[model samples]
Target: MEPTTLTTDRLLLRPFEAKDVDAVHAACQDPEILRWIPVPEPYGREDAEEFVLRAAPGGWREDTMYSFGAFTKSGVLVGSMGLVRLAGLGGLERQAELGFWTAKEQRGRGYTVEAGRAVSDWAFTALGVERLEWVAEVGNEGSRAVAQRLGFVMEGIQRARIVQRGIRRDARIAALLPTDWERTMETPYLPARTD
Candidate 1:
């Protein structure tokens, strides 16, 4: 699938381009971003170049991931987001994982939330995604908060489900299903009852 662009009231979500390497490199330099995300410990220009020139486009070409660089209307790079780990594209499952990171100075402004909603909408409507999972290392409160605000129900922690920098870590897993989209359902749902 070719990479597509999405827009919100305050942001533009588009494919990363070579011109964005500098901005991407700068944003990845933040301590918070480096800590929470799995990028190289000391993110360098070469890494940013590889992401913009290779990885981003490769994922699109492979149809296994859809990554977008979120930017302010003025073209300032605000962060990155993606729908990855695609499954059941041609079957009944239809799911993917949602991941994102915000620029250090851009935190707490709701930009990520706004972009997230737009991306989720695209995944549900354009990509036929039924379930969008969000996983974050257990202690990443900011990520968890964004997922919760976007209405992903906290499904609990998965033991050692994540590996970052070669160390296994527990992850908080959450999900947003089709039924949760606009409080409507594409297919009828009869959730099991424990009572």
Candidate 2:
């Protein structure tokens, strides 16, 4: 269950490669990345190495998650996104959580949305997931905007449901159902201007 390659009009979502560790390390070192994600602070090369070697592979094989390295046609790792927290009852496992982050230099280009849209499609059609859940720190408007653009309906804020850097934080919860996805269709929104 190695993460497979996914594509959209201007992006390619693929599995992390050994060479991507440096880029991953660089992205993780961003304070915003450390702030929103539950990863170790002062993110270093070792942390990114371990993530690529252990957590990511295990996640994909368990069918519990899939993390992709977001690259451009020329193959530069600009970011990463994942379907995580997958769980279900009986033989049903149709729900998952979505999480992503872009490099500091690439923040405003809608790469997250493009990658997310690609994965959401795979999750629903290829993986048989029925619902995709999203949550972001209450004031993380950037992330919330991506969720909205991906058609995840805001379900509301969860009081102190997220703990970051030893502080309790509120999270905006949202979900996208297969019914809300246009299966036979590709993404319709043009990439928002980065400038």
Candidate 3:
């Protein structure tokens, strides 16, 4: 899974580069981003360097996660989105977990949703992903809103599903299937009938 770029009407989702360190560090300083995003509380320049130089690239090289930094056409960093925990991409149960965080100033412009659609479509086609899941710690209305807008069906909640700063927290779970996007799957899904 080599790092690649995905484009939208207004965005260019690409792998993080060395120049993104400052912007990434600055964005993570937002209180809201720190609260909901699981980034280090006191995110520093070194951390940003690690992400841009190491972690993100390493994920792609290992085929474990695919991360993209969402930017405007004019090159403004708007957010970060990634598909982690890629499992069974070579098998029938292929799946991945979607995660993202928007810059505080760029919150309402629908960039995240646009980027999500691009990633989801890629996963379904290029990666053969059957299901894409989005999980947010409970109370993250913003994330939930984006997930809903991306057409992920609300599957319910998971108790103690995530640990943030070592504290257990409940999480809202949702999924987007190939059928949700009108993409045909090799193995058809049969939903249970409600009596």
Candidate 4:
């Protein structure tokens, strides 16, 4: 499956390219990013290249993941977002796991929320997914805020669901079904900027 491009009011959510290594490395190097994600303590350019090159494309081929580079209108690499483990429990591919991260400088700008909403919209409408699930570490307040802003209902907390960097961590689970999106009209999402 080819990675698809999605758009929101101010974001161009597209697939990562080989040339994105530097920006990806920079994004992954942020202390907050390394703290939350299961990346090496000091993310190197090789890791970024391998992720954008090997892991990303392989996941697409296996129908396991869909990652997108979040860009602003002026083509700035502000972040990344994706769906992982996009398969069903009983051979029905209707569910997926959602994850996202933004550059340090891009935080508090609603970019992830906007891009995540766009990804959710595309997953439901274009990919025909029935539900999108989100899980973040218990203390990941930023991610939680984005999930809430995108209208995901917090289901509950799962004790030690995430094993990040060899450490067990609790997670908060949230979900959004297609019907839920259709029913909610005002989800507090930012309008995409066209300029």
Candidate 5:
């Protein structure tokens, strides 16, 4: 799939470009972002360059990960969002993992939530994604909050399911189905009964 763009009322969601390297590099410097996100410790400009100029586009070309850099209307870098194909989506299955990181200064303003909604919509409708899962290392409250606001039902903790900084850790998992947003899809979902 070719790289695409999404526009919200206040932001432009698109692939990271050369000009965005500085902002991405700077944002990764925040202790909070570094603590949770699996970015390089002591992130360097070269690392940012490799991510923007190479790995990001590579994901698009491979049709495995769809990533977007969220920016304000005036072009301030807000954050990054992505969907990694977990299963299916290649032949007959439809599942993906949703991930994101909000810049330190851009937190609490609802930008990541806005971008997440748009991205999720595209994944469900455009990519035919049946299950969009959000997994954050346990205790990442900020990330979990954004997923909830986007209507991802909290599922539960996954034991030793996440590897961060070379160690396995538990994760909080959640998901959003098309029906959560009243969007009808070809694949019918019969969720297990609460009782």
Candidate 6:
């Protein structure tokens, strides 16, 4: 799958370019971003270059992930968001994991949420994704908040679901299904009887 671009009223979601390396490296410097996301502790220019020059393009070519750099309309890098670990493309199950991090100065605004919605819409419609999952370290309230605002139903916490910086951590898992996208029932859902 070729890398594509998405846009919201206030942002543009596009593929990373060589010119974005500096900005990407700078954003990854935020301790909060490093702590929550699985980026290197001391992110460097080389790491940034590799991401924009290799990983981002490789993922798209492999059809395993689709990453985007979120920028303000004026072209200032604001965040990064993507659908990773794409699965079941040729089978009955169709899903992907959503991940993102906002620049330190861009927090508290709704840009990330807006970009997430646009990406989700594209995943559901353009990519035929049936399930979009979001997982974050259990205590990362900001990430959880964005997922919640995007209508991902909090499923529960999974033990040792993530490993970051050499330590295993429990993660909060959530999902937004096709039905959830439209706020309508695709197939009737019934929970198991606990009685």
Candidate 2 runs further than 4 Å off: 183-195
- Give a tens-digit lDDT track for model 4, residues 62-163: 787888999998988999899997876234547888998899999988889889888888887777777689999999998899999998999999999999
Ranking by lDDT: 3, 1, 5, 6, 4, 2
Give lDDT: candidate 6, residue 166.
Answer: 95
Q: All candidates' TM-scores?
A: 0.96, 0.88, 0.98, 0.89, 0.96, 0.94
Regions of model 5 farther than 4 Å from truth = none
Write one digit per residue (lDDT tens) for candidate 6, span 1-195.
978999899999999999999999999999999899998779999999999899999999998789999999999999999999899865666789999999999988999999999999898888777788999999999999999999999999999999999999999999998788664433455658989
Each prediction's whole-model lDDT (CA) = 0.91, 0.83, 0.93, 0.85, 0.91, 0.91
Worst 10 residues of 6 by lDDT: 182-191
lDDT (Cα, tens digit) per residue for candidate 3, span 1-195: 778999999999999999999999999999999898888879999989998899999999999889999999999999999999888888877989999999999989999999999999988898888989999999999999999999999999999999998999999999999999888887779989989
lDDT of 5 by residue, 82-134 (tens): 89855788556789999999998999999999999999999988888888999
Q: State model 3's lDDT.
A: 0.93
Q: Give per-residue CA lDDT, model 1, range 1-195, as digits (tens).
A: 978999999999999999999999999999998888989979999999998999999999998788999999999988999998999865777889999999998899999999999999998888778889999999999999999999999999999998898999999999998778765645566788989
Superposed Cα RMSD, model 2: 7.1
Q: So what's the TM-score on candidate 5?
A: 0.96
Model number with the top TM-score: 3
lDDT of 2 at 7: 89
Q: Could you tell me how far off, in angstroms, the CA of residue 126 lies in candidate 5 after the best superposition?
A: 0.9
lDDT of 4 at 20: 84
